[model samples]
Target: MHIQSCGTAIDVNFKDVGSDRDELLQATKKILQKQLVGQSYRLIILQHILPDTVTFLRMARNAGINVAKVFAKPNSIHKPSLETLVDEGFAVSCLDYGEMEGTEVLDKAILQEHALAVQYQEQLVCVDVGGYFCEPLRRLSPKKLPNFKGVVEVTTFGHNRYSAKVKYLAHPVISLAKSPLKNAEALIVGESATLATDLILRENGYLFVGSKVGVLGFGAIGHSTAKALRSKGHLVTVFDTDPIKRVAAKLEGFGVSSSKQDLLGNCDFVFSATATRAVEVADLKHFQNGLVLVSVGSKANEFDIDGLVDAAETAAIDSDGISCLTYAGGTKLKVLRMGKAVNFHVQSCPDEVMDLVFAETVACMATLSTDLPKSVLSELSDESRKEIAAKWLQRGTYERN
Candidate 1:
């Protein structure tokens, strides 16, 4: 409770008046300062935003990362989308990774842990609403690696600890209980919850109820995406590497499959969220034309975009005199952003549902703690507004040194 030099206090109030989002954000700041050992922590986080990184930072703190005294750069990972926050001097000041090597505060072990975790699993899905792994090595505490041992999974029934990172997922709940027809038509498959949900919604609009759909990867987001598809009257087909999970989906009234070619060739929509880098890349040749290929993996290597780029017309948006898309036919694809990245919470204008979920999740995870210094979860409630605010500002004060 008495974390020192960790900046501000961190505590979220999901229910109350006069208690706003600033309290949540502050909570996050304090925890990160404590866990990552700011004085020596050197890490570089690259992202459009820092919410997910922030979330994981909080989770690390809960696992025992001493954020305040040990890790350096209290605000390195706290690069706020808000121009005001950036201007207010809360952003992580940039440093030369070339210069800050061989220091005791800087831990080569940090990268070693991530490398080990990545090596531990065939595939790893690193999720962050706020920070990146690099920040720990480059700016925070270089003296140590993240406290991987503190990371654990605690459900309502029990708890389980994992050596790998992805095992500490974001969440696992979805609502597909809209109507009886939702159950009648069910099929689920996609690489990520966002993409699976998007494609399944489209599939339900086109396919009739009771249509068998196959879902690959039933992780936290995957399950929700599949459930949403199931609600729209398409049958969800479950296929995954996890035995317990694969069987669970089967028990939940879904057909399970093991072969990628066999499953995609047959299902109306092959939504995949398997949490791997190249999910269906090499094996994508098996998918037939008009197969409605879509990817939602956080890392865009899930599908062979190079192959699909020639098959469709793309939409164009000129950014600073740069053409962002290419129009082919009716398929609104981005030749520039070929990867079908859809923010489920912010799919449309003025939508922050995902951001809210992201902030809440991080807040809860940060309170938990880690061995290495880690940050606490703070509410970035106004991330959308902050994003817009940043649009008007030029590049951050950081000019490569």
Candidate 2:
């Protein structure tokens, strides 16, 4: 196979190297090497600090890409992976998701990239999660730094951010979040999150089966989680701000709540998968006693933990480190995993499942070198994603057979 990008022609090949995790990653690396060859952009990657991410970064470097800087969400930083990244000479930083309502951490990274661009005379590219780089990239002063090539946004939340700023951007923005390939990954992530919640509840001496579960948001993750919970013999109710989603849930045979208050008032447990502040401090009053709140999204902002802490008359931590917030009149709610994504409390997904998205992400980097429409949010071509999927299916089927 041959792919031409950045005015350079490169030969590409995909061969079965076995179907194990390492083998698949090696194959992915070979594909990236051919696609990204002859590119000289300084890449800034923002993703979870995981073993798989370590493999991806190492492969990018091996494929002749300059990985200038790496950043991770504060809660998603895995110690072993952090150590590995640092040991391998990758400049890394953890972004603060604190009380401040600004993009200071991301701003720092942007400044660093600007400096590197001046020093190295290379165009800049960013791979962002959750739209952290959206504003920073848009805010770039062309006079000071005109070498920004583009960005690849990986999450729906981030894609939303980029879309809002599309009119103001000066560089191309490629979104994988809206791709059909990512919808497949979202379903697997949803299942993993539900299983993780079940395991945590069981570990804490609670029976998940008997509890009435509610899912906030009817997006892909939320929809899949509701189905997974129902399959586990739990009655599932869902609430979404969108009427279409509510109707879809009702049609799917799941109870639909008309309002957030009704859902919180009724369910024994709730999964906040909206990727926004689904539960606020004012809404805290609606929570029934003994309600367990589980966050399934990437960030802790799914529920306003700070607001809950301030509103609580008293807070207590159990032996398992679960925090119980007690409001007036004896209403208590327990937050699991300290309001972070519970699925990542261990691993987010099996390596094989994550490999599909990771492969697509690497392939998308090659698009940065191509002439894409500037200042707009676009998806990688269907043909490109199909090609990656076909390769994945071939290796997976071969392994299984």
Scored by TM-score, the top model is: 2
TM-score of 1: 0.45
Worst 10 residues of 2 by lDDT: 1-10
lDDT of 1 by residue, 307-397 (tens): 5554435524321111222324342322112343322212111112223233333322332322222322122224422432233132223
lDDT of each: 0.36, 0.74
Superposed model 1: Cα runs more than 4 Å off: 1-20, 23-84, 92-212, 307-337, 344-401
Model 2, 1-401: lDDT tens digits are 01111111111121212223365464476558667767777888888776777777877787777898887666666665666677788887664654112846666666777688768777677888887776676777656667776788888778877888888876678888868777776787788787777777777787677669999999978988888888888899999999999999999999999899999999999998887778988887788888989888677778888788888899875422368888888899999876877766556665566667777777777776666544367888888888877777766432533
lDDT of 1: 0.36
